[model samples]
Target chain A: MPRTRPNLLERQRRRLVVPFLLPALLLYALFMLYPAFTTFYVALTEWNGVSAPEWVGVDNFTRLTDDSLFSSTITNTIVFTVLGALVLFPGAMFFGYVTQRLPLGRLYRFLILAPVALSVTTAALLWKFLADPNFGAVQKVLRAVGLDSLASVELLGRPNTAMLMVVLATVWHGIGLWMMFFAAAAERVPAELKEAATLDGASSFQVFRHVVWPLMWEVTRTLLILWMIQGLQTFAFIIAMTNGGPLRATEVIGTYLYKVAFASSEFGYAAAIAVVLFAAILVLTLLSQRLTRRESEQY
Target chain B: MNRRSLLRATAVATAVMLSLTACITSSDDGDEPETESSGGGDASGAPAEITGDLEVVSFYPEGSPDFERLSGLAEAFEAQHDGVDVTLTFGGGQDVPQIEARWRADDPPDVNYGFLDVTLPDGGPWVAAGDTMNLQPAMEQPLEGYDGTWEEAILPGVRPLISVGDDIYGAPESVTTLQFFYNEAIFDELGIEVPETFDDLIAAADTIKAAGIAPFTVTGTFLPYMQVYWDYLALRHFGLDGLQQAIAGEAELASLPGAQEAAADLEALVADGNFLDGFRGVDFTSAQMSFFQGDAAMILMGSWLIGEMAAAIPADFQTGTFAFPTVDGGSGDQDGLFGGTNAQVVAAKGQNPDAAEAWLQFIADPANQTAYVESTGGISAYTGIPAPEGFEDVTAMLEEGAAFAPSYMGVLALSQEVQTAYQQPIAQLFFGEIDGATMLTQMSEGLQAAAG
Candidate 1:
């Protein structure tokens, strides 16, 4: 086909597209693409943020293979994702389903999401104090229930429980958003299908398991992938609460990288860790997308 | 609730909290001494050339007394030179990261805070990296308060920390040491004498424990404090040379002759269960709270603890400071103190070298350094200053001929990666997950890899 000049309207729209999209593209390129590519180059060198970078090829990545700290962070990150998914998805779905149909649903939703209003540090501190062994609410409650010995068991002090405490705080801070996500998806479900199932003598659990659950499945899968990403990149709670301590039992990729870069000043090494993390997240997310892909059900 | 009742309840709650807080925090005798109206007064001796915009950064957060003290110094420097505008930036725990960012951009800050210790493998990080200027000249230069040079004015033990051979890279502001801060009332109540030896200390700890009080409070969360038990043990057992042998990769700490005994001593310390419950996860701040709140009878803390926790100390709480007791059969200098110096390091490639150097020299003046000690509650690096208020005993202790070794735990001069990797196994050792020998082996192996 011979090229032809665009009509006036088309020409005007094409001119508008550049004006509209150029700023966004420029910003994304500057803040994201530039740094991303720079980080790749940095990962190949031994740079201490301040000094000129010395090229070290694949040494950093090679070192990571046997690095105990790197392996622990990777393990902990995976644990965070798996444990978080186990607690978050089911709990979110259950509450989201119940809240949508329950009386005073808005109030329930508001109460459930109240923690979201608190900053991560505030929420972490709140949870930390609440679990204090001596004067915390957990101790008071445990003592009230005659679990006196257990009351003094420091939840955040021990290695296993410290990590668990961080995870719990993260979940408390985040569960609300995921719950609201499921709630919105449930709201979109056709009322007729639920009514039909109830009339067909389906118990509430049965109705949920067969009807509502299947309806929310698409949202569930999408949110699961989202939660996994959040879990992988978790940082603030660990820093504010445990600081990757109690024998570094709570360390994850994000916190480790931050320490490596900022504390140790090994920006090059940290960049290597970051590049690997980015690659892993991208590959996993794509794989998740493929694995979760399904034909949409026509109503 | 009714509005009237709500208001009444709020007032009552606030009053209760106020009283409770007062009963908990030690009396802050006074706010910081007023800055001289004469704009830093007459500089004891103004440097010949100090006219420029001097940019200084500190880890002390703004509004903190330490930050205010430093700000006062900068203002003083500015006053000395009409043309100089001293701008001080505070980052609390982030000064280094910020400095590095500025350095990467090729516009480094003129002066910033840092740790300067000879114990660092190559005279600390910036000096090792050659990013800091040699501060020996600033130290050797005459200042108003001293009969001789500023170098002679500094504590003999601390003078070596900033030097790598002939070069000095840090202008130190304070001497830091770890000591036991105990509740005086508890010690008196038990008729327990202040322990001068490790055995006596252990006995006192037992007595305190028998009274159902936590004998000590130390946080496992702060990796530095977590290493203290091992640090003192290693020093006492192996002496400075033997301890340095491990740090320098010449030997494993566990392989030393005194290693077994020191391990036993640590095992005893750990086995005693003298520390407050849940100490592992709680940070240094909480550990301090546990002590000042009277939950723990004693706490081994750095010199900054008093100032850091001044507000939390109750007026009635008699905070007693004592040096770490001497170890029996110890080869290390019994009177030796383990600490580091906080310095204001000028960048080698900074824009205003003269201003920064002069600012540092101004800081080194005896009167100025004395002001720092008097204003901020810490051990001053410069000599001839009275101890900080409430730290008189500590000052007297240092005056009695003690050696000072910069803390060697996290300041290993190794990469943070290696230090963190090394610390994990040590933490595991202290947690009873690994034996002392295993810890030494792991640490040695970890450092050996980095060394390679």
Candidate 2:
């Protein structure tokens, strides 16, 4: 059969689409796409922000192999992401489950989410004060309990404990958001299905394992990816608390990029680091989505 | 739906377009009125009679004492110059990053209050590209009231602080001398004398430590404050020139016997627990508070410390300062001091270069310099200006031929990359995670990598 021409309304709608989409498309290209392409170009040069940019194709990428600081930054980012996911995923889910069953569930949720309201900088500063070796409340309590040795340890100073402190601070501030996500997912589960599981003599854990867990896989996968991206981009708290010290122990790729660009005036090298970070996040996100994807199921 | 409605719509659209065009053209014209002359200043070596905005950006935040003094200086300049409006912008101690962003945007301020040091990559790029105006010719001219030239009015050692080779890039405004400030009561109570040699300093520190007080306290988190120890040690070990040469990568820092020994000495201090507990985690304010609270017996700080900690300092607490002790078996000048100068530079690409230069000269004049010193408790960078009443002792110390040696990180004689690479390793060395030899190796490798 011969192809039919579009109706009058369809033609008008098609013509109208350009006028409506033009502004958004132009904005995206100017702000996002333009900078991204410029970053790729900048990654291949030795521009110091002020002087003329000198082209050095692939030199920055090659230098990464010999750049111990960059390597350490990558290692730090990976460790943070993996450890953060391991802690936050189970912790948020468990808290969400327990709080949902409590008599004062709303109060519990409110209490848990209070920290999320505080800005990241404020939370980091509060934690820094609390971890102070000399006059912190934590140290005072530890000393009172006769754990003088533990009290004497400087959590934010030593390389061994600095990253751990930063991780703890990050989790404390972030756990609430993930918990709220899981709680919302739990609220959406069918009560009848839960009752049926209960009637089948399933314990709370077993019901969650068999029914709720399967249903919430989508939310859990999204949370995991979000946490991974955030962990990779962690910088503000580390900067406020440790400043990538003592001895670059907490130096993630984000902080390292900042140092390279602003502190060292190596804009090209910094752009290369940014590109690598973006690539890693993209690959990891794709892999995660592929792995977590499931066939549609009836509940 | 007749032709009349369509005609009305077109008339409204046309009216809007015409009004918008009128607004744009009027605003543009209002912003830049035609000038009678394009020259920067008139005759008699004064800033030209120009009517325009002169914007100044500074690191001194509004609440700071320096901020008020700077504002007053700008006001005085505005008062003297007719038809010139001056606006001051404060960066709250983040001037480097703020200035960097503005400079990259190609819209830097008319006058920038900053250090001219090239070691840490703060303003070095602009200086190297000649983005800042050369002030040599301006300096040769005499101030309004001062009979002598601006160059002659500046203190002997201050001009070099803001100069790269023979070209002066900025006018030196204030000076700060780093010294070992001690609680006089603690020294008197412990029956300890002011140390004059490295050995004597160590003995004094030991006595303080034995008394269950920290010998010295420093803000290790900031890193630069802790670098003072390394700077003094290097200076006392190898002379000033030798240290500069090492920083410039002309010589290996580790190869210098003095450098090696200095590293070892610093490590020894760490091993002996001479610093406050958890000093590495403390910031500058807290470290100063620890000193003021008498938790530490001594603190190595700049002259600005007296003013910064004025409120916290006890009324009965007497503070005494001494030059960094000379190292035994060292070839450096015993009286050399580590410190920095506060200078102001004019943006070459700014609209009012002559107004900026005049403002600098106004600030550098003997009368304004004295007022600034009095207000901020900072040492003046001008000669023949009597020291502020509270800082007479420091003035005397400076007068005793205590040569000025800029901090290694201050003038950025070394690239920022090299400095950053050394920062973590140096902290590790301080924490005993790495030995002196490891630190030296790391420094050498980092410098080599930067060079490559």
Candidate 3:
């Protein structure tokens, strides 16, 4: 006889796996994959999401070049991304080291991640209250300390200051998650390398600069890529807090896209804006991935 | 691994299936079942007894005290109606796109809030596409108890907004107009008389500035404050109809002499340093509080500010209201009041159109209108309804010279794209970043693009 077929029990077990996996796969396909693909398709059309779409054939893309707001938003996104990378990357690495090495390290780490657990909405509201020009807690404190002008100035009402405040708030709220990641990565660094550096009379700083950083580069590069992508998608903080106001000083690509899509109902224009942001992030992510590969290969 | 385990697995699987089945089945019949009774003896006698569950939607934002009162009213209505239940859904704030989307959906809300500018550029498509009900029949029907407000004394300018070529769409809920709310104490301290003309306003600003207080306070948050400049100047220069004509596309903004003067007048206000430094960053809440804290002497705000101003100030805080200062020698005589009313209309496709109409009739009563006005700090559109308590001083200003001109700018003719486009240019004017003529040019171009 040919190879004996599996028993009914085995056959039934194999069939059981399909049913178990199918629902989750089907849900993912329906909710995530389908919508994402449709969004891509819509991006290429001149549709307002109300009536039937007109085929503009990249006219939206052409229009975006001359649009002052689009260009400004792109600039803001780059600025926000750079600022986040500079602050979050090194700041997290430093904090992770300090928490791991310093006294009361556990308590400090707990405090650091507190904001991370707090919703961005809550954080935005809290900071807005603090930054209020009239009766904010921050203003009151600053006034008591003889910094009356700073207290009186509407921090989020001005242009450059509003942009700065947005970046500062975002960095503060986001640094904790990166710190947590760095701490874990730092902990996983070979104890042998650390001990070897110590035997050679290397100071803590030197040990970190030479051994720890290289080992953690893999993790940092990975995180940097993720943060870069997240940074481009920044919306809630700017929208909830600033609303891209005081003459569009703080309008980011994400917020600009949202205003065009939902507020103005110019879905096609918004899609074009989104495609530009998506392309930028995609390029940055791929470039970072390549850099990470080269760095990993060196070891 | 074994038959015993297999049996347990099937048992668990069957339990999961049963639980899911129960959830799906239960959810499918969430709405209460209505037993239709035919032509029974009812007071409003029509065909079938009105009994059904309704899913209603409106653009009223959640945190308002009015929303809670309305919800309470719905519950009371349900209790009185016996078998009828109403479920309400609220809409987004500061944006109407979400509300419009619901209107265009396959199953729209039973009712919705429509902007007075029903014939917007982008809106034309939807109206043409049949997203909205014609509403002529419902609007023209003499709302039983609403006759007093609906008939005579309704603001003349406001009537046009509710009608399109003689077909009424909605009724008014509240009427608002621009007025100067001033701190009498500050005026007394500075020995400055309240301004009666644009020149006087400029002079008062100088006097107030000399007294070490900001002359004017305007909210930088909402577009209303920025638009007030245009409104005040337009009325003072060419009048409401002149601006209305420009907004209605009857007159080109670039060619209108009144439009030019209005722009120039606003430019003067910015050049005079009447507002606080970087006032563009200062939001409405802050601007409002600034007056209460005695940081500013006067604010150009709507009648709604009368209540808000009273609530924010000290218990004994005294404030006064006056009509916006007229340009003494303007080209046109325009009334300086900006006011309109909101009407509730039933959707044509609504399952319980009659019931919705019934609710509208109930609320249309002056007795109910008074209660709503009291709860919401709004003026009942009904002429017979007396103004609420503590609205005395403001009402006096209204009695003196209140002309009800509905907001007919972006909402009336401009698209959402054009509305947003105006925001930046208008903001720039407030900051002395752009002149009025340039602003008007940009607005005209934006409108033309929308037209295309």
Candidate 4:
């Protein structure tokens, strides 16, 4: 049978979709896409945000290779990303599982997630006071315990410990959210499957390893990507706590980008750093997605 | 309906929407605020009657003494100029960024309170862009209710503090000199006379350390405080011109014999454990607390330290300041002092230039300057203004100094990258993580690269 043409009303409604979408699309283009494309162009120029931008080809990128600070920042970003994943992925999963089996689990979850309610700056400030070498509670406790030598060590001052301290603060603030995510995923696991496995003499650990873990793969993968991105973009807590000090010990890509742009007024160079960071995040995300991709299982 | 009619309707709708969007988002070129003409000139060529809303922005937040004093000044200016309405915007610590955004948006405040140096990028956006009104014209005019020309009324040392080339962009509100602020009680108890030479200073530190108290305390996390020591040492070793040359990339910092000596001296200070325990980790406030609480015997800070720690200072605590000591066999002029100006500028593109100039002139007036000195506990940039009673030592030191050397870190003459290059290494030097030679080498290399 010959298909009838769409009515004028239907055609009008169809046409309205584009116009309706145009406002949001225009906003997205104006705010996000435009700045993103501009950032790429800016990466190749020598703009100080005040004067007109001067095109410098790949000069900024070349400079990046020689920038010791940029190299160190990259190293810092990688370390944070890797360490964050190693800590959060399994740590969140374990806590989620343990809390699921415990009495008054809600209280435990509430306590764990409390830090998430505070702003990164507030949490950082709180931790800074706690870690203060002279009069902080940690130092006080250490001294009280006759560990005066340990108490004397400035945790946030030394290069070896500054970054770690920042990361720990970040984790303390973030682990709750990750745990909640995993808990929700764990809740969705087929209870019948676990019960059947238990009936088959499979231990709780065995059931979790074989049944629960496999089912939670998709959630875990998504969490890993999110954690990786968050880790790469870490800035506020470090800025509040260290401001990339103790000899640039806690300098990360995010802070370095800020310093380059605002402190040094090298917008072009900063743009280059930002572009590299964006690309790094993009590549890692895409690679992780590919590796984590799997055929849908009929459970 | 037929397909052809439907297609036509769709095209019409698309065209209508496009036009509407274009019309809604179009820029209004005609709506730009008209630049008001200069107000009618008085006998002195200054505005006869300053009128209009003058928006003044400051880094001083509300509730602070500086803010209250400035607010009073604004009220006084308003009372004097009947037609003018002075609006003060307090930005806390975000004044620079706020002013920059306003300038970019073409809505800058009539007046801006900020640091004078354009070299330090964070001071204010107007200096680098030449957006501030050239104060030379205003400075030549006699200050209202003052005894001399505005320029003459301003302290000679502070005249050049706010200048770029021959053009002065801002009027200094106060002058701050950096020196060792020691507890007079501690010094008297320890029998450590104010060190006159580098060796004597080191010996004093040794005696203080032997007494089981840190000789010096600094905010190592805040790189600028660490740089203060390094800067004074460099100034003592190489002199102002030599250090300036090094900062300008005309000479390598490490290669300069004076720089090497300064570095070695700094290393010696570190090796002697002069700084507070775990100083590398301590922030400015913590370090300040340590000094005020007597955990540390002395602190190297600006004159503003008194104002900042006014409440924190113990009731019986007597503070005394000494000039950075001379280094034996050093090339630097022994009488040079490290300090800078806290100045205010009028935005060139502001709507109320006439009123802004009037406000600046009023601030420069002796009575207001005196009030600022008293309220802020800072040294006035206006000449003949007496230092506060408790600050006689700093005043005497300032008077005795042969020349004022702008702080190395505060001088934006060197790019921040170059500054950071030395700053981090200086931290290492303090921590004994890197030697003085290594720190100097890094500085020299960084300066060379920055120059290129």
RMSD of each: 13.1, 6.2, 6.8, 4.1
TM-score of 4: 0.90
Give candidate 4's total backbone clashes: 3
lDDT per residue as tens, model 2, A213-254:
898888888888888889889888988888787777788999
> Taking the tens digit of each residue's C-alpha lDDT, what string does model 1 give over A39-80?
999999998654458999999899889777899999999998
**Model 4's A-chain: what TM-score?**
0.92
**lDDT of all predictions:** 0.75, 0.77, 0.68, 0.79
lDDT of 4 by residue, B69-180 (tens): 7788888988998878888887445246566667655677888865245554433444666566777776777776667788777766666677677767888768888888
Clashing pairs in 3: A157-B281, B117-B411, B117-B412, B171-B343, B172-B341, B173-B341, B173-B342, B176-B338
Comparing 1 and 3 by TM-score, which wins? 1
Please give the range of 10 consecutive residues that has the lowest summed lDDT in model 1 chain A: A22-31
**Weakest 10 consecutive residues, lDDT, candidate 3 chain B?**
B34-43
Best by TM-score: 4
Better of 2 and 4 by lDDT: 4
Candidates 2 and 3 compared: the better one by DockQ is 3
Model 4 misses residue B21 by how many Å?
14
| Candidate 3 regions with alpha-carbon error over 4 angstroms | A1-20, A44-48, A297-299, B1-49, B55-63, B94-101, B119-126, B147-157, B188-193, B239-261, B306-313, B349-351, B388-408, B411-421, B432-452
Q: Candidate 2's error at B131, in angstroms?
A: 1.8
DockQ for every model comes to 0.20, 0.27, 0.30, 0.42
Superior candidate under DockQ, 1 versus 2: 2
Residues B1-452, model 2: lDDT tens digits: 23764686577556655654464346423242222224646324665665678888866678676677678777787788776788888854424777767755556788886535534344467777767777877677776656688877776667667777776788876888888889889999999999999889899999999999999998777777777777788788877776666656676767776778878777776677899997877778778888988999999998888777776788888888887898888877676777767788887767677777777877777788777776666798777778864456555655453547776445233444677655656777777778877877777666656655
Better of 3 and 4 by TM-score: 4
